[model samples]
Target: MTASYVAIVLLGAFAGGFVNGLAGFGTGLVALGIWLHVIDPLYGAPLVAICSVAGQLQTLPAIWHAVNIRRLLPMLVGGVLGIPVGILLLGHMAPDLFRLSLGLFLIAFAIFMMFNRSLPAMRWGSKKTEGMVGFCGGILGGLAGLSGPLPTIWVTLKRWEKDERRSVFQMFNLTILACVAISHLAIDGITVAFSQLVLIALPGTFVGAFAGIRLYRRLNDHRYNLLVLIMLAISGITLVVSEIG
Candidate 1:
């Protein structure tokens, strides 16, 4: 790779890692934008998958105890089931419209949270209902390579503790991204280029993640919630602008 390419990839990884470590999501949003400038998305996408997984692994130990398996299982199952459909829709759908709508929804939710001190508790008749939410997330993941927004919104509305909410964000994203990565590899075999790109990006990913976790530890519950809401707002605005531009 050229020096410029190396620079872009590492910068993207560092930014993505920091965002993921601090918020437990948005790695793709940060990194893909940079990587796309130098690499075909076909390869850059897989690189994102690998880097995101690495970022999550770095933070797993800190939040392991906070994960709620009972709640997460349904979403995982649903997401897995929905992946095929999302893949099918990838080339068929108007991705910009879909992303724009999702972005608006997220911004609206953040606004609602700002006004309402307590969000109404979300209830489902069965785990399957929650899993259905995961299914939708997975479909979006397959369609646009974005699977976290829906789940993040759902978890946020549930009024979970900061760490608990983060556990879901990290694990849920890791699983979905892993699934997408495998699908991509199965269709297009891995090459030395992919390996090299991942290796080069690892250092930036680790360094940023380390710094992010430190920042995360310093935030109280109120600050944590505010940060999450702000991140969501920023992500929503980013999505809209990216599509429009």
Candidate 2:
């Protein structure tokens, strides 16, 4: 690879890793924007999945205490059921339209949440509702590497404490990303070139994740919420611009 290619890959990996560490999700949102400029989407998608899994695993120990199997199971079940369906729809869906619609929704929701300071916590969604959201998230993840946003948005509305919320989406994203990676492997099998890219990305991902985890330790609940909102808004903006540009 050329120097510019190497630099872009490292930059994308580090950015994605840092976001995953700090926010418990969003590695793809942050990384793919950079990587797609140099890498084909097919290769870039799997690379994001691999690096995101790495980043999440690296940061998992920090949030292990907050993981509640009872709370997480519903989402996982729903998400698992939704993945194959998404994979099936992957080729049929119109890419530009899907990205545009999701992007606009994200941007609008983030802006509304940011402005609405006293929004009441949504207390009505039971486990069933959570499961449905997870299913949708799974489909999105499978289809477009976008599994994080829905769950992230849901937990925010649920108004759990920072660690609790982080634990939910972090674990969810980890599971979805791992599934996506496996699906890619089953279908595409990793090229030798892909393996090399993973090797190149590993160091930056680890270092960035570690740094982000350290900073995460310092943020209070309010700041963490704000940070997540900001990340979501950025993700939306990235999607919109990429689709339109």
Tens-digit lDDT string for candidate 2 (1-245)? 89999999899999988988898887777888788898877798788889999999999999899999898999998898888888899899998999999999999999998999598998898899989999999999878779989999999998888999999999998999999899888889979989989998888899889999999999999999999999999888988998999
Scored by CA lDDT, what does every candidate get?
0.85, 0.90
Cα-lDDT of candidate 1: 0.85
Q: How many residue pairs clash in each candidate?
A: 0, 0
Residues 130-197 of candidate 1 have per-residue lDDT tens digits of 78889998998888788888888877777778898889877888999999888878888878888788
TM-scores vs. true structure, each candidate = 0.92, 0.95
Error of 2 at 56 (Å): 0.3
Worst 10 residues of 2 by lDDT: 24-33
TM-score of 2: 0.95
| Deviating ranges (above 4 Å) for candidate 1 | 120-125
Clashing pairs for predicted structure model 2, backbone only: none
